[model samples]
Target chain A: MTNKAARNLFIFGSLFFFVIFLGLTVDTMNQIDGRAPEITKDVDAGKMVWQKYDCIGCHTILGNGSYFAPDMTKIVEQKPAGYLKQFLMDPRGVNPKAAMPKLGISSQEADQLLAFLTWISKVDTNGWPPKPILAAAASVAGQPQSRGQQVYQSQGCSACHSIKGIGGTSGPDLTKVGANGKDAEWHVKHLKDPHSVNPKSAMPAYGGVPEADLKELAAYLVTLK
Target chain B: MTVKYQSQKIAQYFYTFAIVLFLVQVLVGIIAAVQFINPDIFILNFNTIRTLHINALVVWLLAGLMGATYYVVPEESETEVWSLPLAKLQFWATVAAIGAVVLGYIWMGLDPQANKTVMGTQLLNEGREYIEAPRWADALIVVSVLLFLFNMFMTMLKTKKWTGIQGVLLGGLVFLALMYLPGMFYTKNMIKDQFWWWWVIHLWVEGSWEVIAGALLAFMLMKTIGAKREVLEKWMYIEVGFVLFTGILGTGHHYYFIGTPSYWKWVGGIFSSLEPVPLLLMVWDAFRTTREARNVTNKAGLFYTVAHAIFNFVGAGLWGIIHTLPQVNQWTHGTQITTAHGHLAFYGAYVLLVISMIYVTMPAIRGVTTYNQSRAYLAFWWMTISMVFIVLTITGAGMVQVYMERLMGLDYEAVKTVYNMWFWIIRAIFGVGFLIGTAIFVYDFFKIGKEPAPALAPAEQKA
Candidate 1:
């Protein structure tokens, strides 16, 4: 082919490709717009709790937020409503050293927040965190321990410690803590006061968990291994 | 040979070294991708795969930079290289140092302690640490950089006139030298160590690189495309302006989630997001110049330059902005989204630009007017397509990973098992494309030197 003809071919090819790319981009945008779930009353209530707490200031949800706290959009799916409610009433009750301040939420507000969370849990997040074990546990019904994992994150338990191989490395890995053979009684006492077990421990103590929730959380922690 | 041609000769050597390194880098990238697909492919070691990725990227970029500096320096100086022998010696020494470092990595494995040698210093292998070369190797690299600087700066001093392109090019090399300052002090603390390391790492890739790319783009178009000097120089100035505006602050993006101060989120996101603006302007300026050129001399080289512009826009300018926003980055920071960006931006903006320079200059060195345009064009498309596929696969995988883990609360192990097959399949597809591109590139490089020259176009005929 003559040089002029070759050059023309190249130009035409580039233009054609550009047109195809534009069409694909528009189609993808349409699909994304269509798939976006509507903001219903349930989601709006959850959003209020999120806004009131300034959750986005510290935590990211679906790739949006500050990194100070764990993402909460998926929290309801991972953790139980009862456990989330209790933790909301008092974060220090879940993780004594949690950086999250107690918001002093009312029972009704907490229920609204739970409903909002449940709504968020149902949104298709497209398989993040990429762990089947966590995904499976997150979907399990009445699993308070699964909820404990969310509590572990939202309460900033992961700021210093890693759980199930995901989190910050500043503190110790929690994967082996439960499997280390500590008795339930010992965990209860330790939860009340961590310094009793190890004098040099930097871990803070929660006042105490209610007996029932404590057993479930302890059971979840033990299964981390 | 004229003094101008002497400088061209030096550039030729640098180009040959860069092309070889490019091929090696592609191979290493393929291996790393394969390992990601099947963790057991390389004995189930993340450390090994990560090492390959990091080291290959570093070497390939350094090689490209060296070649680009050699090509641009003499033209800007209006003189030949100060000492060809010294330049050659520096090239061989760098090759040796890189080889030793790679050997250490494969032999002794990746020791954080072994990787401790700061730039411009001597690396000491205190014991069995393979990754750390003998301290002399580090000192050698510094000496080599000094020789390089002396050669180029002395040439410029003799010329006594500084063009905008020259200024940006020299500014980048000087910053590269300055990057070593923080690495002088090594700490046992990983957090502190990484903080210092980023000064060298981030500064080179995001900071000096922008300057180098802008300068080289201007210089090559002026030389090859018969572009108006004034128009190209103006674009160079605007390009450098945007680079400096965003480059310094962009370092903060790496600082996020690295246990640094929380304020980096705002600083890194806002500034890094702006990094694409200059690059986008660059794309516009490149194509505009090409379209305006009254005479197109080398069709193949022009094709490469145009492709470089398009890929830079899509890969560096667009994709970079997507993840640089603070909100988006909070989730995508360490995921495969970052990997996708790295593959494209590094190869597209930097590597391809250097290769474009080689296409323009290698013929000048051989005193030829035409090359195997078909082969060169084919290789370009091969690389472009493979890179696009790789980016899509990684981005798709990252989305899936984030949803499964963050949204679904799936543990790492379960997620790993579920996504294992898809990761491997996608990576293998990318590898096939990458390998094909590399083979074509190598074949074209060898064939060009052997082919008979075609009739000279008006531009080259004038020269």
Candidate 2:
């Protein structure tokens, strides 16, 4: 093969690879566009709040953002709308361990925020949060026990607590709590007002729980033992 | 002291070591492939099949790198290795490491209840638990790498000026030093453990070995094919550029689900998708140089070299692009597609290139010009054909697996049952082909230097 032939082959090959690349790029772009779930009007305002707060700057949604906050996408799916609204009203009410500062929105704004998060959860993230364990729990949203698992992972609950040989061992294990004494209703009342149960309890009250979310969350916690 | 004669002697030693280990690796590879056919084939059942795969790959590549280094260093330095005794020590240490790992696997198999230790402390132990190889084996492997590194670094330092090829060869060894980092941090957590393993596994195969392949292939072509040194050198430099360009960032692909940042998807996907660019340049350079050569000396070496170029282009370069795209990688990451890409790319491109260097240098080292080209050629063709079949089978299995596992949401067991039979059959068939190829090449190496030389010197005969 002469130099000329070699040069021609090189050029031709480059062109070929370039053409293949272009085709793949177009195909990928189309796939992304087609698969991306449309953002609904119901949650649009709430989503704007999420954006304005740069919620994703600290929190991941469907496994695509920061790790500083809970995975809000799954959280929305797992909790009731009223629970989310209450939490938005005062996250300290739900868990004092939350590092998230209260955004201090009104009842209406909090409701809108919950709607936005609910809409975000419905969007298809193409089965991200790739771990099978996490994905399974995420799929069973609104079931308290499953919701507990999501809450565990999302809120970095495992970072400070252990249950059933999983999660962080920093805090006391909660494995036998329900079996020991606390019933679902008692736990709900305690969660709504933890200091009422034990004046010296380190746990803070989750003031945001509307009645139904409180009921579901309590139901979920009851099964933990 | 004739430089060529000294180089040939070193090359002869490397040829012997390389062929022996090549056959050993092929045998281990067959066993590994068989395990995939029936995961319960081995009763010992200590380490997972993944351990077998990872260890075999590491050993095979180490042997190849040793061979390539032995052949190239003497020629580049225009001096014999400062001490053959040290070279021999390095080789034996490598052998010892391999033995230790094998024994570790066997011991773990027998004493399945032995407590698992992390960084020398008991982490977990059960009667049927997987036991990681004794830390001694890891230590020995690291020692072997260090010895090789010291020997090569010293040899290169003695050379007043470094050639472009030398730079790449040395750069590869330096990268090997970096491959040891992940093992330094032993962890009990599987997620953290796999994260670090990727550092070594992905970095070695996709990063450092690439530099070594490019350097050695170019160097061999220069000597055997009589390509212009300057042109080949320029190509080598460009090849290095391509390696670092994509390889450093391309590591993100392995981090996708390892509890790292989610942005790794975009970072790993985009950059790794471009990993083929340097490999493409390498394929181009290899072919162009071979074509430009006034005369090709060894038919077997030439064939294997060309095959290496083609496979690197298609297997490593093209097919790599197919699955490297973030979206595609998300689906195919741990599936058979990655396996197919790994086997063809690593064996065909990287391993074949090293073997090709051995083929080109064996007769030269023996001071013989022509001998048993037919056997080497036969081996090359056999391995090449088997590799193609293996790639085809795996790619088909991967596609089926992706559909079943992802699309149908079948559980892992169901997915494995669906694809395991056909995939394993193809793997076994390919294994047989590979064994035959390996045997032929090993036999040819012994026969070549022992046979009578042609009437004319090969250099004059070819030109």
Candidate 3:
């Protein structure tokens, strides 16, 4: 083939391909365009909160973001709005080991984010981020240490402690502390004054608690394992 | 040798800067890999390191393509560059824009809300993958691209000489600029936002960029191979045809899981499977032309040119085909499989193409025709081998993830425990190899001061 003929072929081929591409693009646009779920004002505000906090930086809404955090596309269906709000309010409060840092979003902003997530849950993800299989939580609530659990709860231990993945992350996860070698005596001392055991511990002392309550709390802590 | 057009000299500067950025990208990539093992590496955390790595790679590749364009256009047009000053100005402005974006990403904290009040939108990182540049940086990118397109358009008009190769390449650039606009649009719906986002990301990587690659490949073949222009040009058109026919619609592959319609599963699966056809054609055409012109030298240039084709096909083609089917992708969509394909495909296609361009142009720009043989060979083998292992390690990781997460339905932490060893292996072993190979590649580029230019072969002389 001559150079002129080759050039002509290229032009013709490119034009033909361009036409096909244009048709496909139009078809795609038709497929996606105007099919978006209507965005309510609350959802719109919530989306800004979502972007403002850059939630997608860590979380995947519809399979597009870092894998560092769990997918949020179906979060609304997975958890209650109140649960999500509290989790968003202080992620470490619910799961101390959670990598999600507090964004300092206000209650209002959190509501907006909830709205956004509620909207997102409606979008069809084609059943992605398959439901995780987690072992049922061990039932220690009715054990002999139940009084100690009451004392633990009364003291607002959740602010700095977690048991079976339920509570704040400001301190160590106590779910396995009993098995990990924190004896009753150690728990008592640590609870009374955390600095006595670990100088760098950020947990404040519980010295003002009654001696009986402290002993009960220590016993309950040891049963966490 | 052809006369050294002033714009070509300016192109050399861009190429050098690109190499520097390429090295930076590798360093940052290693830092990110290390973070996979130990996330507490001072302020150079995973998010920061990764953002830098991704952005640097994107910008550096852009710089390389622009440089390659400036270098190739004048020679193909048979005229001096139209405005060397405009090219130089565009180069600096482009560099400054990339610099602002990179620095902004590094200094800005990972929390999207970290500096919203203090920096406003000007400096707050958006945290979008590959589009993390702040609003100001986005503006700079648009401006720089516009300047680049204007300069190239004016150069062509002034020269009044255009080949089929130039037409395709310049057209690709115009498309590139146009596609980038969609990324700036804001939508309240996350799914809708992601839909438009792929217009910029997928379209650039798989669509218009392939045209650019086709044009560049055609130009390079015309220079190095003694084969008749008609045959190569015809093959170039056919390859472009495949690229367009497959790539534009192949974007549906990404739409499969991103809240798009269910029909996309069929559309994406069918079209993306064909995306590799053109790459395979390029592989055949490049090697056939090289074999036909057996007397040509510049083995380093020839090596990279041919290797790019093979790697691109394997990484972007075969690996891509493996998961392009919705059945496979349903399990692998966001897992390490995507990462594996990403690392291989990007390296195989875009990264290697830029490196190939550097190999082809650097020696010529320096008034030599070839690299130091042993070092270039070491660089090539090391990079090629390490890249293969990197792909394997990540693919392994992805496979394990798919099994534990999708099949077993384990939670994220449970899957992490199963895959931690693979991540460690990738970070410690393969990451180091990739870094060393990249280092050698950069070192080889500058290791030619004492080498002398050899006489052109009859084939090369005709070019």
Candidate 4:
């Protein structure tokens, strides 16, 4: 190509694509409120809290941040809101092994951040951050997890406790908890009120868990032996 | 060693500060890598460490580019910098900004939310990944950049002559400054925020930054290679044009999972997939130009040019296309896969270009024709090999992360802790090697031509 031709190509090509980009950007703005939930005042406040602590430095939200933490897009669905709030307030207190730092977030700010996260959870991400395939998580055991195990995961139990060398180390290892000779009744009481069995328990009460899920979780704990 | 204009010496100060920050960037990287293994151990915390690492790299690279422009523009335009004082003022302003960011991060305390007024008053971060700098810092940066740009423009304006290579550089600098403005725009919508955020981040790195890099590479090629100006200059226009044409639309890749519509899948994939075409031709162009070689004494300079071209193709182009297509990215979004691509592409495209500028420009600034390039060669090979290892290890970590966490239903924490720890250790080990190579390069840069020139003193003095 001649020099002038190359120059024309440069100017024209850039302008052409940039204009298209601008068009798509406008279209995206139009489609956004349709694709994702509307931003509430609480959600706006939540985004402020998200930025205040520099969460994206360690956490990926919308799959766009660093990989220091898990993706926050579907976190509201994966984790209980209460658990998330507490985790945000006191990361190590909630899960002693958590890599996150306590950003000194207040209860109000935690609520805002959670709201933002919830709003994010509803955003249509084009099927991104695909669900973890069961086969890979259970690949080591070569067996699908039991239903109670599913309940444990769904209930965010692993945020504080461990099972068979997996999960957090904040709470007792339930790998051999059945050997403790605790029956389901006692386990249920511990779930509802950890201080009932152990006066020094730092674990928060999981009383709000649905009674059925609580019962299933207690049943699963005794089977750890 | 023949100094064209006194203004070229102004670049030395910028390079000095930039090299220092580059060192800090490497040190912070080592710390971050170690923290990856055991997070609770560091007082800095992963957040602080990560912010520093990224922020330092960004500043150092920008400083390097700014310095490089000061060095190259005057010669290309056949005039002195229009305002040497402004160039020096920019250097000082940048240094202060770096200090404020580093100190504010370290001593600003962990509870920035509680100290909201303090953070805002002090002009600290708002926590976007590449753009954590607070609005105030952003403004300060904009002002300084404008001052720097104004100086460059005036210098170019002094001589009403334009080279294709210089024009690209000037255009890239203006684009660089303009792109920063988008990041300043705030939106209540998370998707909208990210969409605009990528405009600043992706557009700068993939679009404007690439143009600047192409111009720098062209400048070096012209200096060290026997290729005709028109041939190299034409290649410049083509590559830069393709960069923007494909790159502007290619930003849809970031848009795909950020709450944008599904049309981005096709728009992003097609455009981004075609990005490698220009890059591949760039690699071929570098080869074609190099084959028509002159008796180039500046071997290190040539090495960096060719290497930048090849790696720009491999790192940014090849690795990028690997996941740019939506099907593959479906599994890899936000995974370590992105990390692998980011490191390789940044180091290859920008970092190498910066180092090459120092290699090619510094010797003349220091008036050293007898440059002992043996140490430079050592540093180059060491860093190059170490970078390959670093990238491989990270890529290994990324693969395992994709397979275990995304593919498998493993807990995210378990995938990071149980699976990726070993790779992190390997990456940190090679991180040390990369640091050593950088140190050698910096040290060698100072000692480049301490040896006296050959005995042609009569002709030199007579002139």
Candidate 5:
């Protein structure tokens, strides 16, 4: 093509796509109210807190930012606030091997940050960050989960521990923990107060857990080998 | 040196200063690469290190681009810079701003509280990925860009000797400056904020920057390779036309999972799939013109130019499309795959483009038809090959991550197996390689071409 013709094409194409992009951007902005959660005062503060700590530099949210740490998009769902608070206050207290360093987060800041994450969890990302294929397959297989396994997921145990490769690094891998000579009684006591068994252990006490579920969890732990 | 005016020498300061920033970028980058394998090493905050690395990269490349523009505009417009004092003011301001920003980032790292609000504003480390410069630094950056733009426009207008290259360059710069505006504001809606962030980041690299690269590359090809101006400009228009058509819309790919509509899935997929077309056409045009040229005096410059085109295709065009489609991106979006693509793509597209322009501009400004060819060629291979090795290792790590973390439901931490560790190890080794290569490049850029030993005629065309 002659330079003039190509120039015309360049001008025409750039304007056309740019206009369309602007329109789409407007439409996207319009959809934000419906797609994203309301930004309460606390939520806004939490976002600032996130920025204040430069969290995005270490974590991904909605598949954006540096991927140094875990995805924060579903953190509120994967981890309960109680555990999150403990972790935020002193990262090592929740998990000894945690990569996150304590930044002296205030009790109030923790709540606000959680609120922000709660808002993030509610955003309609159009089903982004697809479910793990193996997890999906496990559910599809329709094998009934053990009561202890249900308790584990419900309690967000995976936030701290991994059974295989599928959990946090803060806690010990329990993939073969059943091989330990400790009985269910020992396991139960350790769960209730890990410090009683190992004084330096960073694991939080599960004493608040129901006695029945604790027994089931203990029973399940012994079978992991 | 055959520099036309006193103003042109300002670019030399920018070029030299930018290489120092390049060193900073690489040094931090090596630290970051190691941190990838062992996140527990809090000796340096990975976030802050990365912030410095990427921000330095942005600053240096812009410094390089501005310098190149200042040099090229004078030659293309057939007039001197509009105001030498203004250009000098702009350069010093930019240098001061860069120094302050770098110090500000280090300060933020030492005290995370520095990023906290002071009278209701984060003073240092805005903490966004690329534009993490503090609020004050941001203002300085805007003023600097405006000054550059004003000087450029005045110079272009002084003689009114317009070429297609200058027009495209102006359009691209305006687009770049406008895209940056949205990043300065904070959107209450996180989703909307993310949407605009993509516009700034994606458009700068893929959209406007590519247009500017086209102008720079076309000018170099015409001057150094002796290509016909008419034919090169025609090809430049076509190549840029494809770039805009695909790139502007290709911003959709980033929209897929960031709280944007599902229509983006299709739009991003289709448009981005065609993004490779522009790079493809650029390489074809580059090779064709190089082949048809009557004389090629600046072999080192020509080599960098051609290398930029080819690597852009491989690193950006090929690697980008690998995971751009929604189906593939769903698994790879936040994985090391993105990291791999980012490193390679930046190096190939803009980093190499800037380096190529430097290779071309240095000899021309020095009035040397050719510089020390052997050293230049050695640096090129050292950098280009080592960069490929780094990208490949990271791509390997990314694939393993996708398998274990996404497909296999492994924990993010669990992916740090010995197998994965191997990738990081290899990557760190090559990170050092890339760093050494950069050192060679900096040396070659300044030291090798210290004096013009002799003049050489334009070599005869092979054909």
Candidate 6:
């Protein structure tokens, strides 16, 4: 084909597509604007708080921002409003070594931030920033025997293995481990020398632990199922 | 040798500064990558290192583009630059502003009280991925761009001749400035904020920048290839048209998961997939012209141009499509898949375009129109191949991440621990290879000083 004719055809075709794109953008924007949530007074203030603090710098909301902090998109559903407010007011109060710097938000600002979090929690994220398996173990919540749970937490097992939907995920989900064909003896051996059970395991051995604590931790893990 | 205008020298200065910044950027990038493997080794936090790396990249690319504009406009218009003094002023101002922004990002803490005594206000880091520069620095960028646009416009106006390439370049610059304005308007409404954020990030890369790349490539093709100006210019128009057509709406791709409405799934999926069309056309035109050239003395320039087009088509087009669909994106959004696409696409399209321009212009600026054959060829292959390896390793990591995190329903922290080997071991190896290639390319660039001048007469073309 002649170059002139071909160039013209391509140009026209691209422009035709451009018009369609423009039309779609407008339609999409219209749908968004129409369905846009009403900005409540508290939500508006919370938004101002969010921007003022630059929460996005650390925490992601709806899969944006640095991944150093947890996603705040579903924070309201994950924790109580009061807990969230208190955490915002004094982050160290909730977790002594929390990386979240104290933003020195006022009590009123904390409430507003809570309201904002509540609003965001309602927004459809299409189930993003997926939750851990421990979060879904509602059946086992608060059922841990005191000694067994204490042994589990004190030994830093939670640092690598998640339970009750909160903890490190480097190890298998202990929430279902009880049903995963492992006995107390298997757990004790694995804890003493992880490489003995699985050659490729990243888990470090805890041979220094007291046999009693290891058995208690293993007993708690067995009950997770 | 062409008479060197004072303004053309400014382009060289920009190119020099930009290359320096690029080297620094790569170093900072390696540091950021290392943090993923072992966050404890680096005193500078991941946020600080990444902010510097990303901002440095944005500034260096702009510096390259500004330099290209100064060099191209003067030559194309066939006139002396409008104001050498203003160009110099703009360059220095830009450098100072960027330095301040980067320092502010590093020294300033996110906590307001810490900054209250040190700096006047609470605002320190902007925190947005690409637009991390503080308000003052962002304003400085707008001013620098306006100054650049004015200089380019006046020079073109004085010449009283406007080529199609000049028009396209100018148009892209204007849009680049305009698109940036939306990022300055921050809001608490997450969805609204995200909608405008994509306008700046996505539009510049996908939309306006494509035109700029096309015009620049067309100019290079005309010089290196003995193609008819009309043939190349005609395709420039067509390619630019396609860029605008698809690129403007391709902003929807980013909107899909940003709490925006659901319709973006279709809007983004359809239009963004077509965003690669313009690059395809440019590739076709570049190959055709190079094949038909009377003499191809600087084979590296041609290699860079062809590689730029081909890589862009694969990186921005194919890989981008891999996640553009909402169904797939729901699984891969914010994952290494996006990171993989980002690395390849940026390297392929803008980065390669700039390097190609530099290789093409360096010889012309020195009154030579040929490459330092052995060194240039080595640099070209090293960079191209190493970059491909980097893309592959990152893509492999992202794929593994998806299977472990999404399919297996693993927690984010758990997935991170499992995937540490990929980022630390595999990605780092490829990253080093990339650095080696970049070092070789930079070394070759400096070594060009003593190389023999290109023969005035056309030589038999290399295969």
lDDT of each: 0.63, 0.62, 0.74, 0.83, 0.85, 0.74
Give the interface RMSD of candidate 2. 17.0
Displacement of the residue B81 alpha carbon in candidate 1, Å:
1.2
Per-model interface RMSD values are: 17.6, 17.0, 4.5, 2.1, 1.4, 4.6
lDDT of 2 by residue, A1-225 (tens): 443343344334434543553454345434432333454554655554443343443354543332223455546544445446656667656545344445555687676677766655554444553444433554467345465554445544444355664443323456766676778889778867867987644444666647666676667667876
lDDT per residue (tens digit) for residues B368-445 in model 1:
666657777888788878888888877777677667654564443344435644865776687778789878987777
Query: Tens digit of lDDT per residue, candidate 3, span B1-463?
Result: 3236645767777878888998898887776666555555556446666667777888888999998988888877766777788788888888787776776665555443454633334346665778878777778888888887777777788767777788889888888889888888667667767878998998899888888988888777766655676787788877877887788778889888777777778878898999999999999988888888755656777778888888888988998999889878877877767778888898988888888887777766777654466676787787778878877877887787777656754445445533556665564577778778888878777775347655555775544
User: On residues A61-82, what C-alpha lDDT tens digit does candidate 5 reach at each position?
Assistant: 9988897788899888775567
Of the candidates shown, which would achieve the greatest DockQ relative to the real structure? 5
Better of 4 and 6 by DockQ: 4
Candidate 6, residues A1-225, lDDT tens digits: the string is 455664565457656765776676566556654444666989977876675565765566777776545567776765445546666877656544344556688899898888888887776654555543443454258565568788876675655467765565434567888998899999999989977997655456788999998998888788887
lDDT of candidate 4 over B1-463, digit per residue (tens): 5559989989889888888988898898999989888887677778888888988988989999999999988998999999887788888987897798778777644546433644333246777888888777888899999999989899989997799988999999999999999999667788888888998998999999999988887888887765788888999999899889899999988887888999999999999999888788788888988998856766788888888888888899988998898988888889888898988898888888898898888878888654677787888787888888888988888889888777755567877888788999999999999999999988987787777544544533332
Q: Candidate order by TM-score, highest to lowest?
A: 5, 4, 3, 6, 1, 2
- lDDT string, candidate 4, A36-56, tens digits: 777889999888778878888
What stretches of model 3 exceed 4 Å from their correct place? Answer: A1-37, A79-94, A101-107, A129-225, B1-4, B110-114, B117-123, B449-463
Interface root-mean-square deviation, candidate 5 = 1.4
DockQ of each two-chain model: 0.04, 0.02, 0.25, 0.65, 0.73, 0.22
Clashes of each: 22, 5, 0, 3, 1, 2
lDDT of 6 by residue, B1-463 (tens): 3336646867878988888888888887787677667654576666667777777888889899889899989888988899999999999998888777766776654434333311322355665678867666778889999999999999999977877778778888998899899898657566777777887898889977887998898888876665687888888877887787777777777877776676777878888888877778888887888778765766677778788888878888888888888778887877677778888898888888888888777776766545556777776677778778878877887787677655654455555655546655666676677777778877876766467755545345341
Clashing pairs in 5: A165-B411
Off by more than 4 A, model 2? A1-225, B1-8, B11-14, B46-50, B115-133, B188-191, B453-462
Q: Is the docking of candidate 5 incorrect, acceptable, medium or high quality?
A: medium
Model 3, TM vs. native: 0.82
